[model samples]
Target: MARLNVKPTRMELSNLKDRLALSTRGHKLLKDKQDELMRQFIVMIRKNNLLRDEVEAELIAAMQEFVVAKSLINESFIEELFVGTETNVELNIVEKNIMSVLVPEMNFTTSEAEVSSDVQYGYLNSSSELDEAIDRIETVLPKLLELSEIEKTCQLMADEIEKTRRRVNALEYRMIPQLQETIRYIQMKLEENERSAIVRMMKVKDMGD
Candidate 1:
């Protein structure tokens, strides 16, 4: 590696050595952080995958039931049945840190102006299939929200891991090696100066004798 362009002095050598020590230490710490972030990222990704699959399957089943209910009922009545429906949703968003990366945590409380079920309209007017579909959708809503949180967390963690990897590589491959080379150069220069001083003293003694 190309050594740093610096004066080959003891002070410069001491400075370079200190820098090398810090760089190596920083590299170790960053590498550890990167590894932990990756581990957590993998776990979240797996959870996201599972949650996505479950949510999709549930939604599909709910849609199938809705279609069946639609076939049995009149279109206008279906719309009227759902008219004026209101659901109050309160979502709580917060951040949690994993390996210094901030990811979101989401929770929500939902209350309906109507009852939780379609029983408000009575069973005679509404088909069981419609009720089943609504229940399925309600059950999957929380899972969908959870899936969204995990996906966002995974995205943020991936970004942090990439940044940490770059820093670690820069320190390990570029900064540390350059400092070592510069320190060696300064040490060699100092050794040469010492040997020259010894030679001059010996020559003076011989002349004196």
Candidate 2:
């Protein structure tokens, strides 16, 4: 660590001591914040990982079920049944603060959220596989949205954690050390000057005698 460029005097020394104390307090505060942020980040990342795995598995299962349903029916009929259907979904994102990081919390509303007891189309041509496939996809839709929210939150938290870590490091390894070194240097200079002044005073008295 390097000493700050400052005059070696009682006033400067007092000011440096105040600065060093402030820096020490600031360093401790930043370090505590860093630790708390890391804790929050780890919890969110683990939740993201688990939710991602679940969403992936469900999506794959739905896709596989759809492929089987397609193989058992005419592709044109499948397209005609689904292509014109409108699913109105409204998505809203709100920001939540976690460890001083603003992350997104998502909400969604679907227009056709109700389950129909009666089949929309004739059951004569509809295979059970097709019905099951559609149901699987419908069930997984909310989970997909939840996974999106969790992933976004994790991303924001990671960014915040990295920033906090940098600040903590700067205080612990750079600013605090520099302040301490400069304070020590000023103290030494002041002491040496006092000794020199005392020697001059003795020399002057002996000369007068």
Candidate 3:
């Protein structure tokens, strides 16, 4: 590695040594952070995969049920029922810190929501299949929301890991090496200057004698 462009002096060497020490310490801390972030990121990825699989299966089943329900009911009536349906669920978004990374937390509030069936059409016109389909959809809604949050967290953590890794590499490969080389050059220059000064003093002493 190339030495940094710095003055060949004791003071410059001292400053470079100080910077190297701080850089080494920072590199160690960032390595630790990268390691921990990787661990958590892997765990989050696994959870995201499982949750996505489960959510996909649930969605498929719910959609199948909905299709069957649609086949039994008139399309216009189904559309009207959907249009008239009222939902009172509220979602709150908050952030939490993990390893210096901010991740999302979603909280749902449905205190005012009715627990009864959401199949708002008249019983005489709506089949039991429609009610069952609506119930299945409702059951999977929370899991779907949870899957979204987990996936986003996984993405955020992965990004942080990448960023940390880049920083660690830069310090280890570039900045630290340059500082060491520059310090060595300065020390060599100082030693050479000392030897030259001693030789000149001896010559002057011999001339006076």
Ranking by TM-score: 2, 1, 3
lDDT of 1 by residue, 93-163 (tens): 99988878889999998886433643456555678789888889888888988998999999999999999
Compared with the true structure, model 2 gives a TM-score of: 0.93
lDDT of 1: 0.87
Q: How do the residues 1-209 of candidate 3 rate in per-residue lDDT, one tens digit apiece? A: 99999889888989999999999999999999999999998888898899888888877887887888889888999899887777778899999999999999998866434346545557777876777778777877888889889988988998899899999999999999999999989999999999999999999999999
Candidate 1 is scored at a TM of 0.91
TM-score of each: 0.91, 0.93, 0.90
lDDT by residue (96-153, candidate 2, tens digit) is 8886788898998887533332336667668887888778777778889998888888
Candidate with top TM-score is: 2
Model 1 CA deviation exceeding 4 Å by range: 112-115, 122-125, 206-209
lDDT per model vs. reference: 0.87, 0.82, 0.87
